[model samples]
Target: MSTVYLVGAGPGDPGMLTLKAKEVIETCDVMIYDYLANADFLKWCKEDCEILYVGKKGGDHTLPQDKINELIIEKARTGKTICRLKGGDPYVFGRGGEEAEELVEAGIDFEVVPGITAGVAAPAYAGIPVTHRDHTTSVCFITGHEDPTKEKSGHNWSVYGQSNSTLVFYMGVKNLPMIAENLMKNGRAADTPVALVRWGTRCEQTSMVSTLENVAEDAAERGFKAPSIIVVGGVCSLHDKLGWFEKKPLLGQGVVVTRAREQASGMVKTMRDLGACVYEFPTISINPLENADEVEEHALQLGRWDWVIFTSVNGVKHFWQHLRNAGLDARQFGGINVAAIGPATANALRDRGINPDFVPKKYVAEHVVKGLLDLDIAGKKVLIPRARVAREILPAELTRAKCDVKVLPVYETTLAEESGAEIEKALEEGRIQYVTFTSSSTVENFFQLVKAEKVQDCPHVKMACIGPVTAKTLRDYGLTPDIQPEDYTIPGLVQSILDDK
Candidate 1:
């Protein structure tokens, strides 16, 4: 039987997408997505999956409802799995029910996947809880605009006005005056609280709160437009105390994360969720090795070494890159030593079908040296293949202890040239709220790509360096480090920012 899946794409953020929606998007041969659906969500699709954009923007749908239904049916009939991705819950204010009816008439097999609806999600993101113990127990969610072509039907606003229930209206900006008037006529208090939230989940979210009597005027003063929702009743009063999103220290500030584009995903996602605008600017690009000579040389000499050290996941990745490039397997390191400087780097080795022989309790290079010296390596060999700019402390320590150390520069760190314009633009416009320096080279290389005058433009922006070394490097650029974490991991850096905030 032909099958179709009606999936909710969540609010604007790609991270908000449901696991089922992500799974369906990956497996489906065809996908029809909404205009409000985030473009990043489409990245989950396989390389060959057919994607059709059937979005509705501001009530102007690119494809008519009937045409969308016909397309789904046609796609399913071809014996391919079909996915219909919609913004928010597929059924809430969406024409998903109507489309489902057509699918049923066409005898298509289908399933509905519910999503975090924007009506509720947006308010939560703004730190306004719809239901609180002290707040009203009942909540009403109604469309602000009925079919404009139809005669406006009168709803008894008095029931909602007299009751203590919270009232939430979707698509309500167009009928703000009428909604306020009806509430006032129906016994709603003139001073009842009201709030308008625009572009709720995304970075562009703006909100204004006022009493029911003056909400329309307040919205007008703030230039509130459609694609915004209205929340009325006493819960709207809690925004000041309960508002969390806007309270982020760097809220609305724009910062650029300069990790490699592939590796930058985690940092970019974290910063954006913390209520800051993030631009991706990769400072370094990674290229895999083309041959197995390096991997074979290290693997074949493994048994003679007392410790084999990996400092970064990229080091582990590139090592494996050479291993695969040379057609060698994990067994090549038999009886040889394995050590990782950090937990993340150690895990990378475990993921690739081998366990690290030794991992330092502390993740620093000094800790790795201490751990290695404690081992039996009086006449042993140690292989340390790492980034070119790594500190020589480890090799120097091993040699002083009378251990033979073979050092190979498997990867060279070069200044990335792609970040010139973006950093300058962000600096000139005063958009950067934070610039985190993870390594001394990253600090130096970033400034090398961008000129000295441009770097000085963002003097007031908060600067975070991962450690004392990176912090010193920032001082050379004529800026002081405002936040430096005790531990230099990415998560530690984020926690430091949160703590200082």
Candidate 2:
């Protein structure tokens, strides 16, 4: 028999997703997710997993409540594990109880996985703790969208207004006036602090603060829309002093990363951690060389080379892959001196128990050639394992030093097939503040996707290049990079952006 797991997706932040929720999503055979849930979480699902969108937002119902319940029951009967992914805590205004009741009635087994509700998390991200000891000890979560014309109101405004507790309302922006009026009429102070957090917990989170008396008017003037959380209490006043998320240097800034998807994670994390809304636009995709025979053949004869050079981390990785495939290990290159172009490439070599003998201070072809020249490679046999297409300056310069240079193409880079719509839209809307290029290929491919003619559409979008080579590529397209780190690495690029801010 298959079991149904009703999992909570947490507020809007993908990081808030529980480990259990991720595990369930990875193992589930089918998933029915809500619209409010961050779709990024779906990446955890198996490629062949059956997914259903039963999300309901306002009146835009993808599937009615009754129909969703039936769908869950029917999917569970297929003897496959089903995941009902809901936004926020499963039982907290998610109608998870209703679904559970139906499953029980149908004699189906089910498990509930609670998640972080938006009420608590949204306020915390906005820097207002729900339960500050100096402020209020009690906190209440309420739905502001409750029907006002119902015969019997579901909430007791009289009790809530008199209680010394923080009040948090979900989906409350539209009914702000009525909610404030009812609270004041029931003895709540009109001067009480109120804050509305929009798109809370995500990169675009913003909060507006006001008193109960004029919060509705303030929100209207600011054009605060739905999908916002309203917090009413003394805790709302603490936001200014405690607001940390929005204070990040790149908090509201949108950045586009043009590295390959597999290599973009580190840069993406760095930018996101600094509070920038990062959009990954992989312009170049890395693939292993079609024929690894040369790489494998050279790996077996590694002892013949006096110096082995790696220009990029991908070179180190692909080289090791082929070396391992040929039943060779680091021992094969025991006497061979290793030279890495940069710290990242050197670190990649070190990770596999090979410490590079030379890592140039500057990560460029000229620096690599200059550093190798100082190492007396005059009569040496140098083996360079790198991408299929790269600057020939390193090998040409090394060969001029009387060294026998042998180049092995271990990997290749190709332009990504898909043009990223999200990145293009963000750029067109002038929402993207920075466009990062990690390599010459990335710069070329990115310009191909976002034509040079349209580059003027986003005049405010600054260019960031990882190194001088990438910056030169941008210059070739009639664009000058605004941010270029002195260190020429991902961390350096991120620090340069932060330093500029």
Candidate 2 C-alpha lDDT tens digits along 342-390? 8888999999999999999998888778877888887799999999999
Residue 180: error of model 1 in Å? 1.3
Residue 371 deviation, candidate 1, in Å? 11
lDDT of 1: 0.79
> Which parts of model 2 are misplaced by more than 4 Å?
147-150
The total number of steric clashes, by the backbone 3 Å criterion, in model 2 comes to 0
Query: How well does candidate 1 score on lDDT at residue 21?
Result: 88
lDDT of 1 by residue, 403-495 (tens): 888876566666665848867887888877777777777788777787867766667777788777778888998878899987777888878
Tell me the whole-model lDDT of each prediction, alpha carbons only: 0.79, 0.90
